[model samples]
Target: MGPLQIKELLQQTPDGQSVTLKGWVRTKRESKNAIFIALNDGSTIHNIQAVAAPGQFSAELLLTVTTGSCLKITGQLVESQGSGQAVEVKIDDIFVYGTADVDSYPLQPKRHSLEFLREIAHLRPRTNTFSAILRIRHALAFAVHKYYNDRGFFYLHTPIITASDAEGAGEMFRVTTLDLDKLPRTDEGAINFKEDFFGREANLTVSGQLEGELGAMALSKIYTFGPTFRAENSNTTRHLAEFWMIEPEMAFFELEDNMDLAEDFIKTVITYALENCKDDLAFLENRLADEDKNKPQNERSIPLLEKLNFVVENAFERLTYTEAIDILLKSKPHKEKKFQYPVGWGIDLSSEHERYLVEKHFKKPVILTNYPREIKSFYMKLDDDGKTVRAMDVLFPGIGEIIGGSQREDNYEKLLERVHEVGIDPETIWWYLETRKFGTAPHSGFGLGFERLVLFVTGMGNIRDVIPFPRYPKSAEF
Candidate 1:
């Protein structure tokens, strides 16, 4: 049989059962009479202590064992005499699979700055900080699927390459196979996209929501979780050129229905992480606490576990955009003229404004709805007043807008008018527009940035750090 995972092995009672473990050496120390090695298999944040009498194993074999080296250890599990762990492995035999030179290996037993870790992202997963984040990431992803499946939501795989821009932002990465040095042009002296691979100007999709809506129309409920691209050259802790998005669309659902689903969905996933990833969360919580020790008390964040519990236990505060605007206008920062951006009725709310509502004023998750039509996407259902749309943005503490969605404009005429008003060729997304023409229903959906959720749950500051390999403007290295 294969070797037992450290996670399972740790749970077994110390009944002198023979076992074999294969993992990387985290640390190794040798005394005159005994040698102790802390080994981890990336199965858990905790490591198993393997003890051996001096010269039990060949000196040459033990010499090759170092931090980052892979090994196969045959041992008997027994009660530990040491602290921090319940059981220890008494080594009976050892085999070295591979060795990492102590002098050259980057991941020595040391505290690494997150910035420095980003530079070597390929190896960061082995570190405690990243390992914990990755494990929680997995848990959250699984919970997302489980939540949707339990609710009868069909999983939809949307196209990655398309001719339409869902967000109308026009910042997209073009996908083509034409040679750049010798380009093809039309009689109009423009680049002939007809000769390109897709025979049209196609780009990596910025969102799967538009296509996801089509599925929801037929399936009644659908969700899309996939990679999305943006060409924005943003270098902030919050932005990434490429990221994953979770968008769920539902037919016969209005703005209120959308809000309810989004709130329940987010809370469910957070609860899953808190329950399933206790050890990782504890480690991250301690790590964050240590990091916050140097900060001023007022600026320091609440404990990670408490912050997560706060979100899970409390109901989100819901308010209209106009009400939120009034609150922001009366806020201390706005009244004192400390806000960088002007707070007005029709202006797009910035991250600072959103955070102030969630983190300061509301002190919980806040759902701001009915944004001004001019500041929102054209697809949102226009309200009776013709000033605002049925748009909703769920803002969370630390991270401002975690989910953005709206009730779709089901009226074909209104949708067509809005499509034209936004300067988009109706023919480009004629397939999507056709849904409103033939079998229209009041439908709504929202997109949750997966990395943003990871950032919040993992309590990591940089958006790039949560993603396995972040794709940004200037870098795409593994």
Candidate 2:
């Protein structure tokens, strides 16, 4: 009955003492005289089983209560004689504050497909999958704060809406409030952005790295964990229109130091999630393990726990872009899947290339570094070799490039040249350039796609499952 964690409830110290608990109903069943209900309040992955006895709880009363109903229980804590669990609660009283209607309720007792559950996104959190996931989410978030804050990093909140293209990827979602009627026009027939919000073109941020870089210049070390939006028309399992990214920026740091921070932070989060949410991970692991034993070799019998343990215990495989190219050349003749782009020295590694490198060759998480200069963003520091940039991507087996980062160009002249090389207007980045003009120092950062990492760690097949009410193409539904 106490507002205690479900895992802790199993070893209750006050076995016969009265307690109070508030949780939503997971499942409810009834005999002729008594009622049994499973309740979870998100303190833990395991749900508490409550036994409402005859005279105290009317079975007919419980039958009226539908799924997703919020209830409070005052009861005696006792171990269950039921086959499934070693614990149960003997309910003394039940106060149903808000009961769900059976006819209008979206979540039924029957199994619902994820696609269907996504439609009713508002109510899906009451389901077991989401409830456990969000609990893990909270713990991981706390872990992030702990990891950074302990290292003297200030939490910086970057702007959601911005006037600059950080990535220069042309994947920005436009932010405009201009009048359609009597719209401003250019010298040509095309509509111009002369009259718009901020008096020019603007967009939702794709990553907080750029702004976080500005904060790092002033604050020494800072990290931004916030929502980012992209308008790229990607409908794959790994893409989301809106997602959360954690970008950490540091001053006076080189590429090696940046990689170390990234590796440590990622491992810390994995350890935190594994230590804190064992029951949830176990449930998901068992679900995936039992799923389709008759499926193909690549599909079936995946050892998620072993791979994750290896990641936690061992070092991540690190390879330069040039070395990766060598591996790709040797693999080309044997590979059945054709790559979209030619695999060569200067070409960008396609998403498929990333998947193959991490999943096939490394068989672990890989840190691929020093990418071709032309393939990366303008801000990445150009290597001494002149042909490659100080860029890196942390690619996992199932999740390709969960983190993309680089050591930024710190020299004013070179930075300006790269700015011109990328064809972005120099006038727009005047403030960013001024930061280098005044006491410049080498700096680096990475943007980690929060949902993608969660997908890999949770063993959730789709990116949408890890994110609550996932926003993708035509998916702004509640």
Candidate 3:
């Protein structure tokens, strides 16, 4: 009764004993003499069984209760009936805290499509699939803080509004309160938002790498975990208008150091999740997949411990970007063979190329390094050849690029020239340049797409499902 989790009840010494529980009704079924209720409290993925008998309860009354209504129950926990359920409870008391209109509420007895679930973001969290995801998300986020703080990396917060384009993607969501109807124009035809948006052209931050670097120079190691925005109109299972990113910056580090940190960071997270949220992972593996849908409880496709087994037992592959390109070019798959933009030494890789390099060529999570200078961000350190950038992108088999990072260009003069060459005003970045002016080191860092990593671990198809409120184009429904 004192804030008990469902998993504690399932794996505890409470069977056939009276217990108190509270949750929304996932489903309820009624026969002539009794009523059966499937209830979950978001404490765990498994629903506990509640049975109300004929004399103390009416089947007709139980059937009247809506699926999503909030309720409390005092009952005797019992072993599962012969078929169609797990652990069950014999009801002694039932109190309806809040009533839900069955017809109006979106969720029904039958399954709803993920697309249908996306339209009602607020209600989706109550469903089994979404509830499991949010729990995993909580566990995963906790693992991130634990991973970095244990390594003595300061948790830094960068500004949400910025003048710098950290990704150089030019797809920023403009942070403006100006009236475009009466805009101020310069001497030339180009209109100036400097007098408009926050007295300067400002937009939401795409990455925290720049500010994170400043912290690294001071603290030796630092990481920024926060929301990042992009205005790119990419409609895919992978892209989102807003997402969470974990960017780590380190001093006296190089490309190899960055790779080692990322690899260990991933392994640490997987280990933590398995230890913390075993039941949710098991629910996903056993109950969610269709192939194992009909399999018995012992033979379910999903298992909480198997994900850790997969990540820890198998070594992730590492290859240079050049080698990845070669793999993609030689891939026998039709999509890889007929890429729209032909692959060459200097060309940046397409998502298709990246997926093939990981899923088909290497058949595991792969790290690709040393990209072309013309294709990557300007802040990346120029490799020795002067044509390639000392950058890396960690590509997973299902998700293309889960992270992108590099050793920064710490040369003050070269950094300034890079700013100018990239057509950005040097005045705005004077503070950033001051790091190189005072003290600079050979630092390296990378930004991991947090949701994409979740998708990989859970085998969830869409990026929208992993995030609670997936903000995409033309859809902001709560």
Give the clashing residue pairs of candidate 1, or none: none
lDDT of 1 at 345: 97
Whole-model alpha-carbon lDDT for candidate 1: 0.94
Ranking by TM-score: 1, 2, 3
TM-score of each: 0.99, 0.93, 0.90
The best candidate in terms of lDDT: 1
lDDT of 3 by residue, 1-478 (tens): 3756666677665457878878889888767777778888988887887888766766455655669988888888787764755667788998888878987988877778998988888889898888888999999999999999999999999999998888777899988887778778888967687687477889999998899999999999999999999898888988899999999999999989998898889888978887787767877675456645676876543343554465556677888778877766666764446766677677778787887776556666778888887888889998878878889887765457888888889899888888888887778778889999997888999999899878867768789899988888876766
Tens digit of per-residue lDDT, candidate 1, span 244-355? 9999999999999999999999999999999999999999999999999999999898799998998998899999999999999999999999999999999999999999
Top-TM-score structure, candidate number: 1
Instruction: Kindly indicate the candidate among 1 and 3 with the higher lDDT.
Output: 1
